[model samples]
Target: MQPVRRSSRLTRNTISAPETAASSSRKNSRKSSQRRIRCTPPPEDSEPEVESLSEENSSEEEEDMHEEILPKETRYENSRTAFQGLYQEKPDLLRPSKKPLSARFLTQGARERTSTVADAGLLYTVCDSDSFQPSIVREFVANLGDAEPRGDGVAVYVRGSLIEFSPSLINTMYCIPHCEEDSSWMDEKLDKVCTLLSGNRIKRWEDMSSKYLTVTNQVLYKLVCSNWIPTMSYTAMNAERLRFIYMLHLRKGFNFGKVIYNQIMRMAENTETEKKRRIILPTLIQQVILIQRNVPPDNSDEAESDFPKLVVKDKKAGLGSGVDSKEPDLEEDIDQAISFLKGIRSRLKRGEYPIQRKNEDSESG
Candidate 1:
């Protein structure tokens, strides 16, 4: 009975501290082994293989991305170059005179004849020479496409949009008569023009110097050359351009509106091919101003009034009308001449305008 009464507390106290320390030391060794295993490096050969595989995969991804982006970049570059070539620089545009030429400069007969031709009035329509915006002209020229035949009229692009500038539109805008037929430019017509300008039998291929022109014709010639079919060489005029002046001189029924449209197309074509050529259409500024303002041809009068009326000094007022009847200020004339002559020699060297011999018949015998 006394043996069964042995205390459980005494049995628990008899467990040794040494055995507990041994169990804890075994757990600490197991944890240390795990740390060594996790910290171990891969075998040398295996490391190279893994690194190579990752590098190859990354390189392939980069190559694929580059291939995808190359075409878009190339296409963008090509388009930008083409657009730049088309626009180039701001165009050198010839503008209209700020002041009207005195009627006294022209003969009485010449004045009467000029009054009869509706197209000639366009020259007298005063344009603010300073108002001409080269930037706008350049933009318009950049967007202008080749003229396309549309129904009875021809259409061209203006600021990326198609606009019809047919004879009807020209007539409506400028109040000039429209002709269904274009002017005939036969060799005979050219010869006739040369004859008229030279006051002698002349060939179409010959160049007529300004010195040979009559005083009245000289004034008309300058007006026509300056405002209409302008050329760099004022000393000598082209036969083709002379024909236009001839037509105006006769008050012929040919369509001057169509002539203007044709000249615009011709100038545009020339600009694309020739790098240094200047746009010599003064009247074009008016057309562009109308277009930019979106002024309809039907109601352009309000817009038209912005241009001063070209008043011709009456013969009765003579030189005393405060209009300087003398030749244009000498210094101003020299400046203009120098400006016109600039780059002309270079242009001639490029064969833009070949020197033509005077006709044997036209030459004084």
Candidate 2:
């Protein structure tokens, strides 16, 4: 036998520390003391108290643990609900419940009900339920050789009908490259498009459905009747020559070359034509009316003395003497009118007013 191993303890006070302390304290006091004890109730009366405390601790621990997990899923669900509420309140949302044909406001839902067709020559018509009917649309489609239906139910007919004027001219879809390139032709085009009107075509197109067609045709006829052939011919010729003209000036390194010279000539001719077409006619008409309205009194007759002479005085005097003399010459046109009326009366007396005479005999008999 070897010495048994044991766990080490503090050897100094291990044996008699508690007894020594008690004995020493008793020795110092030398007197005995008596104490009384009072009975009291325990904090809890039931076994369930321990269990309830333990359960509460466990629930608090669980809540703390749960809060440590990822929170994106919860945030995303809340955000989605908020976004849906906002979408419902937006003003531009299309309401399917509204009627299609009421034109006060154009809703996107109404766009679904309307249809369109583009015939030959870039003619497109927008047809809606209240205005352009399906029958008319189909007729327009049939007139075109073939038709194709778009996703929006618009049937586009190709080469079926003719648009009298180019669509580009109406909306400026296709703009002329040199429309404002300091060319007199541009001014002429503007003036022709604006003021020129054909009286005959105006009468003919009075019953036409399309207002643009009437206006454009009237302008076209006026341009033709006024001998605008030379001007338009130059336009057509110059339209083809724009590229060549540029090359001659830039690439050929020529100053005032044949191309440039020709362009100058074309410009001068176009300006003269434009002044005659746009300025002269309108100015002359205005001057004649001014004279007629501000006529001076005649000299001889007392009754006519109060009446003014039909003479137009030019305010821009000495600048245009040629146009000034021609102003009184326009009054000669009135005398010619009187002579024409006399001739018409003489013919009427000889039973030459064929249509009037026929109507008169029919009424008399």
Superposed Cα RMSD, model 1: 26.8
Question: Which digits, one per residue and each the tens of the lDDT, describe model 2 over residues 154-208?
Answer: 2323223332111122222212121223333222332122211221222211121
Q: Model 2, 206: alpha-carbon shift in Å?
A: 26
The local distance difference test score of each candidate is 0.56, 0.34
What's the true lDDT of residue 319 in model 1? 20
lDDT of 2 at 240: 20
Total backbone clashes of candidate 1, pairs 3 or more residues apart or in separate chains: 0
How high is the lDDT of residue 138 in model 1? Answer: 57
Scanning candidate 1 in windows of ten residues, the lowest lDDT window is 316-325
Q: What is the TM-score of each candidate against the true structure?
A: 0.43, 0.19
Off by over 4 Å in 2: 1-156, 159-166, 169-328
Runs in model 1 deviating more than 4 A are 1-130, 146-163, 180-182, 189-191, 199-207, 282-365
- Evaluated at residue 127, the lDDT of candidate 1 is 38
Q: Write the per-residue lDDT of candidate 1 for residues 1-365, one digit (tens) a residue.
A: 55643576566656766788889989899688667556567667643577789899999999999887768788999998876776665222222344325635334555554563344446432232333444445545554466578865566665456666565565556555445453564233554565666555233323345555554556555555555566655546666666766766665555655666677766667887888877655445447446535633333222322332243322322121222222235686679789889778668667676433234435655
